[model samples]
Target: MRTRPRGDAGQAFPIYIMMVAGLLFLALAFFAVGKASALRNDSQGAADAAALAAAQKARANFGLGFLNSLRANALDAFLIAPFAPPCAEAQRLANANEADTNSCTPTSGYLRDLITVAVEGRDPVDSPVLPGSEDKVAKAKATALIEFRCPNPKVIDADSNGYPEAFIFTCLSGDVVTIATADIERPGLWESVSRTLFDVRLVDQ
Candidate 1:
């Protein structure tokens, strides 16, 4: 019978141990990457929801008879600034998604109809897949836009039908105009046309 030398004894055991350790390291790295990817997705989702909420509020703005261009009370919407309600809406939505809102800024593009939202996801301290992610936070940004399709108010008619078509107002300066219902040829059937408002869903940026 041949006996194994002392120096060579259990050498196979060390190699096996090393292989197992390497496998475990690879598995941990894969898990960490997966966890981080999931967190990043969550952050982006939260940002989108926040931005959409804010934009919806701004889209609700509208002006009624003799208000947009004519002088009237505050029961109307102003295109000059629509920041506060939308910002508050964004904050509420971000909180619901377990994210903290960093900023809600109104951006330039299409005049003042764009809103941008930034949020940070809560750190996953309890993550089993990525232990170190507890100290790392996920962040994302999104933009929501309001697109207006305004019908030319100057293209007036007696009613919905194009009758008594040509009408002009000296006081009106732009496409948006407000005039008395009596001024319309068919006062009883007259309808005021303003900027048609709608919102585009959030886009990750």
Candidate 2:
């Protein structure tokens, strides 16, 4: 109070600087978190899109009655390859690393090489609502696996479900329909980027 202002002025300056510095640090931390979140979302979206595209291709080829096994494998390979370049680019921007081959090994919970497609055929059967009338029905299931290395090596068995599943249906009127049922769960700070697509194709019998 008594002639203390002159001496305390310089001391106050340091306190002001410290406050400013703390604020700056907090701002930077928040910015970093936001940027990381955005990147994670982008990577996840890309993965889902790619998986769906590949599944559709597999369905189309199967409907045409093409080489089932080859088509399945080819479609998976084709779909996954395209994603590599884009995924790599995304990883770079996000400062993330690409998945290693060994990461997808059979022993690992992540998917490895082959894509699985399960086809189920249902013929027209008597509808419960329409006693005399018959209804057309068919169903197909397809699944694809994209393996990636986990950021935290300590984390094992990231996915308990094993693989994502897609369901497809076709009505007698040659109407194709598809539905996808895949749920993504994250543990700690890590999350799975899974893509699912439902596609249906009708053939002229």
Candidate 3:
């Protein structure tokens, strides 16, 4: 039987190592992209849900009472509830060498802003210029921010040059919701107008 070339064995080891390294790199990239995408989706969904919740609450009562009520409820529901699980999950997934969950706390500032914007934009109404009109315009708005961390350090370059140069990825999005109601012509219209505005803002949030 013919013997294999003597030098081939030495060459084969480096090739194997290179192939394994390439595979690991690709895997890390895929994992990081997937994680970032998932987090982005989750954040956007949470924002939309929270906004809609605030808006719906405002719509029901059609006044400042509605917005105030929803704001109080949302303090517990949206801002705190959704984050608790992810905070724990982040800690569990963190590596010894990687930054701990403490780094994630800074992101809470964005969450607070998001919740505030959503609640504040809950209702805004435009009443008819003429008396005895049924045409009224209402509007609502909401915003949210999302951050994603990669499990593998290799995928993200902390010092990379780009718009967002940091290893971490952050995304922000805003949405507007609107509804209209009948306009009435009468005295003390401003009270009704203010109430409608509050309700509209709540609905949009």
Candidate 4:
């Protein structure tokens, strides 16, 4: 039986170890990249939801305000709109999507009609794939917009003061109007004009 040199006995051991280490590193890198991507996607979803939520809230306010105008007809209440800060709605939506809101603000040049939101993923992952990256969290941003088109809104000028008091609306063909104090005394004289409300929705731009 021939005995190999002690030094050569394990010469291949180092190469094997190096190969294993390299493969392990590659795996870790892949895993880290995948984790980061997933977190990024989650963050993006959160941001989108948040922005949409804010826009939806504004839409609701717009509806209510227009309805009130149909009742009061004294002022264009929409000017004072956004009954609630859109950021609050965004925060709520971010939480639902397992993310925290980094920032929520209305887009410039758009009055309560557009919302933008930035968000971060909720939890930090302990990643061995990317050293020192474990502390980093995923972030994403989104924007949502709203617009309305009143095809043929009949502006109500009940007071004849040039300030519209209300708008007359009809879901299909029947007119719906709120009874005013004067309307109680004399029907159909001071009520809002019968017209179609604006078609409102979320827009990509």
Candidate 5:
């Protein structure tokens, strides 16, 4: 039996060890990057949900009594009118998604309202391969728009009381909702009608 040279075996062993170490380091680096990316995506989803929740909450809070007082043409102002920021809902939703709200702002536009939210992941990205990144948390931002879906809403003329008697909201989806002024007296009427008249969705920030 012939024996391999001891010097050659010593050299090859070191090379093999170096190669394995390099590969292991590369695998760990990739894993760290993937984890960071996943956390970022989760943060983004949380931000989106929070923003939409804030906008929807504002939409649901539209005062029916206020709407009843508006003129026929001015009724569309419901979306743009200044109202309380529904940031509490955003915070609640962000917490539910394992994130924290960084900021929540509401902006009013011509016929729409926008809720912008920023959030950070609850957990930090901790990886041995990424030095000083253990304290780094993922962050993301999102915007949600609340716009009226009814393009040509018809308002019935008011009676002697000068208050509009009814509203015929013809939504873009060909759905019609007729709301009598008297309906305002019923509880939960605005909550039910607002969903049909307004559309809440995520929009470009």
Candidate 6:
């Protein structure tokens, strides 16, 4: 007959069970951290998209007013013009990314415009390690800038007041765009011209 099983082996079985339980808890905790990180990243991406969309919309809206200013021989007025609020665009983009826009603010200066947007993620952390993680959401903010690419205009013609009646702009891409005050009234002209004259980019808030 075999000798009785050792009592030492029986005692070690409980220790093994405890070790496995501890390890499982640690794994779940790590997984929870990773899920939280992913949620934050998604929130940041949504904020960036919302801010950029707002800035771009503001830049496009500037086209009509800018064209009108040029026609009036008041380009300087357009340079310091106020931007149309683009909060609606920001909201649309945030929703598309599964987030909500908490705030959208636009500020404009001489030839420069900036839009800042804050967003909250729709999904929660939802981690097993934290009791209330399912109710915890992520938030982030981003800013975007839209500025005139060419500050100086190469004057093709000047009126008595030294204002440009016709001008050539050397854009950042080294493309020359010529505009005459007389031809600015053509339909859909500003749409193409505005894209070339302005540049949009993300910026530190």
Q: Please give, for residues 1-205, the per-residue lDDT of candidate 1 as tens digits.
A: 9987977757878998999999988898787777778888999999999988888765553333224332322212444444444688898999999998999988644334678899999966335556566688889999987654432334345554434334343222334344543453343222343322233566555
Models 1 onward score TM values of: 0.66, 0.36, 0.34, 0.67, 0.90, 0.88
Overall local distance difference test of candidate 4: 0.63
lDDT of 5 by residue, 1-205 (tens): 9998779988899899999999999999999999999999999999999999999888877655346545444665655577776999999999999999999998887567788999999888899988889899999999999887876667698778666778787888788988786676778777777787788999887
Per-residue CA lDDT of model 2 for 1-205, tens digit only, reads 5565687888899999999999987886666556445544444433333333443343333222212212232333333332221222222322222211111111113223223322222233333333442443232332344332211112122245532243233433344333232211112111111212222222111
**What does the lDDT read for residue 198 in candidate 6?**
89
Candidate 6 off by > 4 Å: 1-6, 159-165
User: Which candidate would rank higher by TM-score, 1 or 4?
Assistant: 4
* Model 5 pairs whose backbones collide: none
Worst-scoring 10-residue span by lDDT in model 3: 147-156
State the lDDT of candidate 4 residue by residue for 39-149, as single tens digits.
999998888888888777766555444545545643344543554447888899899989999887664332235677889987676687666786788998888865443
- For model 2, the local distance difference test gives 0.33
- Top TM-score hit: 5
Q: How accurate locally is residue 124 in candidate 3, as Cα lDDT from 0 to 100?
A: 19
Model 3 Cα lDDT, one tens digit per residue, 39-119: 444443433445433333323323333223232333223323233223333333222212222222212331232222211
Question: Could you tell me the C-alpha RMSD of candidate 5 in Å?
Answer: 2.1
Clashes of each: 0, 1, 12, 8, 0, 0
lDDT of 6 by residue, 1-205 (tens): 8887799899999999999999999999999999889999999999999998988898888877877776666778888867676899999999999999988887878878888999999999888879998899999999999989876777766767876678788887898898887777787777778778988889997
Q: Each candidate's lDDT (Cα)?
A: 0.63, 0.33, 0.32, 0.63, 0.83, 0.86
Q: What would the C-alpha RMSD of candidate 1 be, to one decimal place?
A: 7.6
Error of 4 at 123 (Å): 1.7
Q: In model 5, which range of ten residues has the least summed lDDT?
A: 64-73
Global fold similarity of model 5 (TM-score): 0.90
Query: RMSD in Å for candidate 6, one decimal?
Result: 2.3
Better of 3 and 4 by lDDT: 4
